[model samples]
Target: MKPQLAHSRDPEMKSSLQELLIYMIFLTDLGILTFGMVSTDMFYLNKVMSSLFLDTSMSETGNTNFKSIESVDDFWKYAEGPFLDGLYWDASDIRSSIAVNGTTRHIYYENLLLGVTQVRQLKVRNNTCSVYPAFRAFMKECYGPYHYLSEDKEHFGLKNGPEWWYFTSQSLSPWHQGLVGLYSSGGFTFTLPKSKNASIDKLTYLKEKGWLTRGTRVVFIDFSMYNANVNLFCVVRLVLEFPATGGVLPSWQIYSVKLLRYTTYYDYFLAFCEVIFCLFIFSYIIQESIKMKILKEEYIKNAWNWLEILLLLLSLLAIVFNIYHTVEVSSLLEYLLSNSFTYPDFYLLALWQTRCNNMISVNFCFTCIKIFKYVRFNKTMTQLSSTLSRCAKDIIGFAVMFIIIFFAYAQLGYVAFGSQTDEFSTFQNSIFTQFRIMLGDFNFASIEQANGILGPIYFITFVFFMFFVFLNMFLAIINDTYSKVKAEFSVMPSREFEISNRIREGYRKALAKRKLKRKSTSQNAILYAVRQDRRDKE
Candidate 1:
């Protein structure tokens, strides 16, 4: 009997080992699949995606002046102070040229289009123009003349053209693009027209004021040059090359590239693993459905089943979109390579990629949530579900009533204090502000400033009804439900465990009955053989 028992236990141990091996293999496969996906994404971002967003050309050039007058106009509209006050230059100077040895004073403007702080060197002829003599003198006094003056013509585009007068300006630090920076080294030349007389009186007036001297010309510099329209175009081009925001929409073109790249090696392996796992899940669901004998509609009525169906549908969509996007990108690349100068329209590609990303993000979230289904078999989870189920209707009713009162308070606050406080400036803001107040972010000073008398009354009443009364009631309902659910769960086994226990008991009984029948049959056979022998003897 001991040997028989040990033999029986050997099969069970083997079965357990087999199950463990399968689990380990599955986990390894899952890890590989995840690693492959993530590695591909990182590679794409580093190698390809990042290039799409960065303006490599601009970076190489160091200073690419904004060409549009609209940008300048926009800059002037928003700029203030004496430095920005008279900073506008005649647009006609763009095409005009400065004389060989002549000096003229003019203002040159540069817009830092990308909102980044830049150090720029402006080169000018030795006798050309002096940039804001008073400002320059102040900078020279503080930081020294060498720090504010550089004679490097080749560095500031002097070699490009003889007519070009270089002007160098250091923009405010990148974090503070709104503020103007102090005067820095370098200068630009502006040529007075041959026919027009030099304004000596104006020069003398400026000279007496120490703005200019016999040799130095004066030029005013400003660096507030962001234009919305120009920026939109830049953003689109940038997003195509890198992973930055293109206006309001997110850029996911690089992510798509990574997904496509990884598919070459891991696609089949991942697919095999996914299919095996999904088949098991599908069969289990089918078995459950058959046992329940429920209609299709009834089967989907379960939240968990609905989630499974949704996950399946989303996965299918993701695969289809991925394949389509890959083909499109490949075709576009081929065409671009052949044409050289031609560019493909990436707007549709970006749009499709955005949609795909949204789908992927939603699928990832649902996958995370689906883990709860397996955990739902646990006793604590079962009790939690029961408590939530029992209290759902009451919670919904309370929420509806609470919302009505909350909205009323929000509207009242908006109407009463909208003019006085920014938080309560509108109906929408008032609602958010009221929520903030509940979270203890309320400012009594702002409320008191709005209306001293009504402010305290509103605060007191809102806190009493919303926080003290309704909030306590809400907590009490949940606590009571939890207590009841816990007591019930302690007394009775979970539904899943109860069903499994019954099945195991029935299987054991069936095995016992079969053994008894087999033993009885053996005894009958022995008796029959003895009877036959006695008959032979007779």
Candidate 2:
């Protein structure tokens, strides 16, 4: 049956209007709820999809095993073919049947294999060897147990030992393997098998002496053998593949690169969103600076806008790159070829592409912006002598303050961290770690691990500096500088104005002097005429 539509012009249409309004409200609420639910589901689905294989070589199979799987056909059959869509991945290598309680349960173990599933205990069994425990041992063997955050001894207790994060690396090529050390800005290191020394450059002589063969199995250890003190973050493994040609040229030999996912994708998604928001902020700043009429210094404003534009453009590029990598699986080859001349494995590329989109790319763009703003733009001060002295004073004042803060934090870190911290115990480390803390990344967990007496004090001091002193000081300096610069520009006349005023004054004075001279000459001529007339009459 068709429902009758009521005309709103009639007074009797009140009932129909109320019903329509109520239906509209209900529909809006339902739409909002549906959208929210769909967004959440899509986010989770993206995470799952991104974790799939994009690395060229997905595992850390030994050279011998990798050699056995040589040839494109065998490679597909043994490794690539197994993980393709619709093929059942045989967990048979890592899976074991264990007796739990009275029955047997299938358990899959997570060893050192890269691009594989994580280990999870589905059920508990009596006298059963769960895969998790063995996986932990295997992890210790493959990737050393180093941690950025140490446990709190007073709270968690010493008997339990230190809580740590494990790091690992997998080889992509049969002979050439790479290691990446993770740090705030830690760089990468490549470890080549003795045979691949011909392909890799800058390898230590000791590595060359080790065994040189195509099939020899070699472990590229990250930590120093002489010292048990392992780096808190060092490249466990990074696999890069290059062309099969021998070339000394720096640009030609480089191939593809990849990094593993130590953290989740949401961490990156949130970061990418942050990059967009940051670019928005830069755009807003540019608009605001343009609106600031009081600032007569056009160069400064232009420089600032240029930086803002550069940052916004870089950020947009990063966003587009991330979106492309996220959506298309084949773009990795293009990215590697353009940037580093290497085509990273699919999984490595996926990890690299995802990580690039998330934090690394954003951070890189941010750092570049900061460098240009502080160092490059500030150098322009040298070109103008009037502002040079003031600029020098400001620079020196900031440098001294920075030095004092750095030393104070270094001392605090040294006293607080003591021997418990590796890669951050020395004076240099104390300074670096202090800088990280100053950036609001102070880890209380690491602070609680120090010697009972000094640990708490150090932790407190560091936290106070980071959260209270540094953060507040940073903002305060900006506020103060803004006030000073605004006051100067607002009160003082511009250089062009002063020059124009002087020129007009000179012209006015010249005209007035000319008029005075003309009047004097005219008066003198009249007196001479009068004197001549008197003489003629006499």
Candidate 3:
């Protein structure tokens, strides 16, 4: 009774263990799927952000403590004052008027342009009040100010002399043809006012006219410039900061500015769903890893197992890097909001995130490859496995011979044709080109260009040997092995079950052979003893 109970309990334990293992495997699969979904979502979000940000035309407005000066009255307020005494001021005779209610007095200041230029030039000058300090900082941090200036000069060649080159060649577009001619041809300058009295009067008058407003007023300035080859129309915004008090000196600032691109609600929702999915995948990977009973060294020996581990590791790394990037971006944005003197440099974060996303995408591909292991359980896949396995040794031996000759040809082609043809640029490229030719992507013209007559001979001979002869040999080996494996598998009930049964039958036959040998030895011994007894009787 006790033995029966023990046997029953043992079976129950085995069944429970099997059930647990199944549950774990199921959970692991679920987790992997979830992570896959998460990775896809992240990729989608990245694409959306890239597209939105790349489209520089998309803009959003925000209230800033910057001033806007739309008319001559606003400019005169700062220009006539003692504020100009310390700073250089140049005005242009190119007066333009925009009909707001009536024609508002708009005078383009060349001195203002000079002032902006000088401030930019004086990199170490601390006293120079810049309206777009954040912009300057952002540019300086992301791309050095000098480098940015140099690039601008190089992009738009310095034809109109160094001092006025940037301003003159800045707008390259047919749309701003008249405006560019107006600004370049005529402009005015005024030295900083020696006293504050004159500037105060102008400010007071402008204040009375309701031009002096609190915070910043952003004005979009459009212009066009043409280089010899291309015309570019550009827009720049002016940030004007006017203080509440009339006597205080006002701020004038100009720098390149960009607005942060906004993301849609759908993007956020998708990201949220992805996060949940990724969590599940992460959990499953961890559990699967722990359930592995093999030693680390032994576990890594299996290619599929190693791949699984690698996928898990890369996913984790990607997730960690992404989290860090998100945090850094959020922190940077917060810093920008708190201190307007600083701006967000999303380049570093964007680049880092892009790299992580790319790695995750690769992991997803590998995961798909890993799924083939399960597919191999099918009867058709089993036959494929057997065929491939049987052909593997022969293929490996052939590959060794093939690689030597292939590389020899590759090197020869590279040395002979590298200078003349783009295809044979390097040994690696030569090898790839040969492979392409084998696949019927042969470019006779390009090959002929390398050595003319010799090129065609070399290409024809190489193709004849490698593609027609060697490749056919490779295919023949595979085809022959595949046929044999398929025929053998066809005779079997099931590949796996048949193999196990054959092994068992072989074991039983070995035991039967041993038993028969023992029986024969015993019978021979008895006959010998009986003959000895007869001799003794005689």
Candidate 4:
């Protein structure tokens, strides 16, 4: 793209140099501030939340004992103790409007929550599987609990692949049919009214449904509660993975508490940062639009054009997401506040906010990367670009060969060890296992135990071919390309290298209207009167 300037004040400086200088100065500041906003919002939220739930604070609340809620009894311990105490504080802002004889009910939890009293005394409350619509929808679709893309995923609570929808729904067997906490994607979703009890009622129900028994191997439980204190819903996930065949009751359990917060002060600042980045986006759009008008079909040939397009697309989405997050959070928080006594359902909003955060992160990354486009004047960056461009075809071919060979090995590994080895159980797992093997994270013993004869042969050959051969082949391709690029750059200056030199020449030209305008080596005229008479005579 040609950088054009109208009515040049300085005769020395090129238009491109001025553009790069301005672009770098303005865009880098904007990107840094935007990234900081994202980070700060998360940091503040986490800090406050940690104080409420972690370490010493939780110990004070008597919740430390039941922190790892891997079983039904552990959760009951938490609910009966700190959870009830927390509700008293959480409901402080939303105390009941209902009155007894022209006076507000002084019974806090009973008045604030739908039910917490029996015989004019506070009774322990119950917990239930989440009734959040989006959560149920996602579960109905048979999607698992966690979001991270991983190879070693275990859908301990939800149903599994190919047959997830069927086995989860229509063809569901007795044991897992109404498996209590998490059954189908529909799950054990019950109205969290007075009926939904937090005690071992669900476990008993699970036992009745054949999901839990004396000989059961594992069970996973997930539930949520509303906190009006922060206007956020916290979800608690549990895993009861201890051995049950030892004639002892399952004694080991694990739990994690996760929550997404409402918008913070920095969220508004983030919106401001979005607008700042918008200016840069607008500038690029104008540049690209002008180039497209002039170049027409030829504009499609430039890869930078595509990067600009992608950057603009992400920027637009980020702006929309920011707006969505703010508006949705405000409205949802209001709704949740009014209904603070009931279970809060903010799953979709949380998902969207998380998705928005992820987008802004990607947008900021692209914003930083966009700086490279303006700074191609640097020799090393130029060489790196050249090397990639030169080896693009070779790398593409190499990637194809690598995937084919890699997939072949993955399939073989799955066939040999998938049934017994957890890492090799799924196709995605097999691929990740191969990658991990190269990284020295694989368990050779597990592989051998899975299939004694094929295990050692598979491990050795996979390492020999992948680690020693194809992987090195890829590196060699890059090394050779970079060497050629280095030699070429050594012989001839890049087109942009002239801009760097021109920037040096335009140092004084770029002074603009600053106090030190156009630096001069001119001498000052020192005036003297009577004192100069002796000097003049001399």
Candidate 5:
């Protein structure tokens, strides 16, 4: 991270102070915004809580308590409400209260979900006491002797306990309910209680806990009405939970986690970019101002090298940010998979949404600076020419391969789809798909629709070309060419000098060949004359 000077006649430290000052002003404004974000975090939490409460029809119970608890102790004290007394058990009490008596009071029916047979309805009551385990023996306590750490809450809460976590969505029809979307180490896998119809001899077994009869229209079952004496209950409880559910469960506090996540990454990325910009400014200033005796070539080369390395790192950081976003998106996909309703293509539409835009901007900045480096250093045209020639050769090779494949696929597509559908029936549709893949605009839905409308012949053909042929070829080319681009500027030279050297070499070779020919002819003539004289004397 050391700042080095530029190599020049005066090497006046590249005075970028003005530029640095402007950046500092901008950063100061940004700092205010960042501070505001932190300060408003509580406000965002309240907003999320309000939204969730509205979604669950809890707003009518009373004015929503969107107050932020500044600490875990505050959360615990609030949880001592009468409503939680019946649901959770402390670890000491868990061993004894293997079974609990609970009457299902009322049930409301919802029909939005697709194939799910049953969904649970959360009951509300002002007088009902909420059950909670004592901290000393709470099975959900993070630091307890027998408690398991809860991913959602840092401290013990009803959500941290197996009883509450499992019941949260157990009876809900997957079709109507939204599965919490939280990114995890891998794709999502959730386990629920074994089916009631499962054989008794099966390892998984449960007893009917209780039933709530709201009317003839709806019946809610409280599965905790009965408890089985088995050592495998904890395993069964663990199975009911989602593997990818790392954030706060979505009941009340999930939005807080989501907002915090977005805020954290967003600020970090912005900060990283700012730091890089600062370093760049500082280096430029030092290069212009410092006048230490250093070899001009060595100094310039080193400074440029440092710039290149930093630019590469910036690109890498942007890539990681994009990847993290992609992971978040994949988690959202898991939620959709768990539910049955078809939502509009929000994720697809938002794919390039801010996340991709930031990455693209970062890449553009890096590339612009890189090109600027060559111009600023006044690299010779001959070097530029050589670089362009190599690039041209590569382009030609790639074009040839692409054209051959395009034609081949287009022809095959015509044969397969021409009679069946208008889309891929002609060579043009095949070419369009190829173009889309190249531009990273390929759409699975459109492709599938084309196949469905046309037939299996085109589907199989296009799939083969898209996956086995195009994907591999494109990736190989890009991966192979990356190093070439990185090394290109180092070996640039003047075109005029190269041509002159070639001409001189040709002239020297021609003159040497002529001299050799003349020597051989004279030697032959001399031998012939000597032979003739000998014959005459004899």
Candidate 6:
């Protein structure tokens, strides 16, 4: 039954209550979406990738001949560090593993591509030097003008290896390829014949060629590590874009992945739920579009409306990608199932699926933000909203000033300590390292040691301005606005939600009707008793 609104006279209140009620129905769909998120991306995909985790440097796992990388000093140490170490297996192992005892009918593979499109010698030092330490052997020493970690030779022991490499651009990307060279795949050191007059290190070679990133900066550690008979393909792809400084532009993706199913029952059920969720989003979009048409300018003006549009766009992209991947996977699998000898090239599909998951995460965040719009009428929430909006202009001004000073300090630290300290090795690293210093993860001794006089001066200025002055000023602005909002809300009496008021009104009327019926029944019983008493007296 449609409930009556308490503030019937206020048409605006009535309309808002109606809208809130409709939104509640749409909110039910989030339950399924959340389940899919936790089940698939958070747990399931991690499990699949984890199952493939191994130390590629070890003999048990296949090896990589890393051509795309610039440095080889700590390559052995790196091939085993964080995340899974990618593997390279011959096609025979892949085929034999799946056909004999494998529950997995098919397998797919992808190369572990590392580095930005533009590879630099400095970045090679930055990425590796301090990241993977062997022990108390003191790995941070690598973060120096000189790679001093080599002095701790007992810990840094894959010692007898290439001090340099040559970059030969691959006119072909080896997606259908795995590692070459010997076991442990160690020979990246490019050597010239003894007849030659001169030899070049990796750094000298890149400099002479005039550094380019496209093919040389990246390493594709390919994997066909189809574990004896177990099924999995695992690798990582990551790049941080700096815009004039960075933006991650897309490159061609390889279709070298096979979709996995842990259990057929859950897979089918979750897939069905995904279809339902997508359909609900489509319906919700149509409803919101109608409202958008009715309230054109106002709709566009509202930030919450834009969030809805973004959520819908992300959701739409995910849905379209999912459909395309499904069709493509099915077509490929159909051919593969028949032509059992053929290796699968579904890597491109896997890459896009991962990207799709990232968008799902964005959609989830926007969906959560949209919740505030529906709950804005709440007294506490209204105060918070008012406080933020009131100080928004001031905050914006503060933010601009903050960025200028922050960049100034970051650049200063980068230019000063970048040569000797890992924390300030790159402009971006300096920016983030400054943030860490703010958060109290600072290494003061290192900062001071980077340069005795300038180091201390730079830090003192950064702290005094950023932490002591700007931070407190920003906090004061927020505190002042909050106090004003609190006072304003306190002066105006609060009303319960219109939907809650309607439900209470229905409950009160039902209670009154029940009491009236009981009263009439009691009177009727008393009259019957009185007539019985009169008959006994006669």
Per-model TM against the reference? 0.44, 0.30, 0.46, 0.61, 0.22, 0.61
Better of 4 and 5 by lDDT: 4
**C-alpha RMSD by candidate, in order:** 20.0, 28.1, 24.0, 11.9, 25.5, 13.4
Q: Which is better, 1 or 6, measured by TM-score? A: 6
Clash pairs (backbone) in predicted model 4: 70-253, 126-197, 126-198, 127-198, 139-185, 140-185
What total of clashing residue pairs does each candidate reach? 14, 17, 26, 6, 32, 17
User: Where does the lowest 10-residue lDDT sum fall in candidate 4?
Assistant: 119-128
Query: In candidate 6, what residue range of length 10 has the lowest lDDT sum?
Result: 178-187
Candidate 1 lDDT over 1-538, as tens digits, reads 2666656655554454454455456445444544444434334333432342222122333322122112222222222211122222333555545222222222222211222111122222353334577677554322112213433344232234322445442422121111112223344433212112232332233334432222222122212122221121111221101001111111212223232342344567766765664564466457556745756567767887777677667766766776787797577557745643322343345445656667766766676666555444346667788999999999999999999999999999999999999899878899999999888888878988889999999999999999998899899999999999888767873333322343477689999999999999999999999999999999
**TM-score of model 4 relative to the true fold?**
0.61
User: What digit string (tens of lDDT, one per residue) describes model 4 on residues 1-538?
Assistant: 2234322423333555677778776666566655553434334444433343332224554444433555545544544444334433333355554343211122233322322211000011111124577576555322222211211122222343221111122321122122112222222222222322432364344334433323233333333444444434433222343232122122221111113322567645645665677787788789889999999999999877887788788778866765665676566557756754333334344445556656766766776787777666567888899899889999999899889999999999888788899899888899999999999998899999988899999999999999999889989999999999888777873344445566665665665534344233121213344447768888
| Residue-level lDDT tens digits of model 3 in 158-186 | 23433223233222221111211111211
- As for lDDT, the candidate ahead, 1 or 5, is 1
Candidate 3, TM-score vs. the true structure?
Answer: 0.46
Please tell me which model should have the higher lDDT, number 1 or number 3.
Answer: 1
* Model 5, residue 202: C-alpha shift (Å): 31
RMSD of candidate 6 to true structure, Å: 13.4
Ranking by lDDT: 6, 4, 1, 3, 2, 5
* Residue-level lDDT tens digits of model 2 in 6-116: 222223333334434443443343233223212333343233222322222334442312224433233333222222321122344534332222111111221111211
Residue 476 in model 2: lDDT: 70
Tens digit of per-residue lDDT, candidate 5, span 1-538: 1122223311322223333345456445334333432334434433433443223221334422223322323222222221122122222343342232221110111101111112222212221222355643543322111111222211112233332332332221222122322212211112222221222221122112221111101111111111111100000000011112121122321211121123356566765755654565456456444522344456556655565556445545645655665585556446646752322122221323334444545544554454434333233543454455556666677678767867776776566555654545457776775566555665545544545654455556656775677668766665555546537655643212232343467689999999999999999999999999999999
Poorest lDDT segment (10 consecutive residues) of candidate 3: 114-123
lDDT for position 78 in model 2: 28
- What C-alpha root-mean-square deviation, in Å, does candidate 2 show against the real structure? 28.1
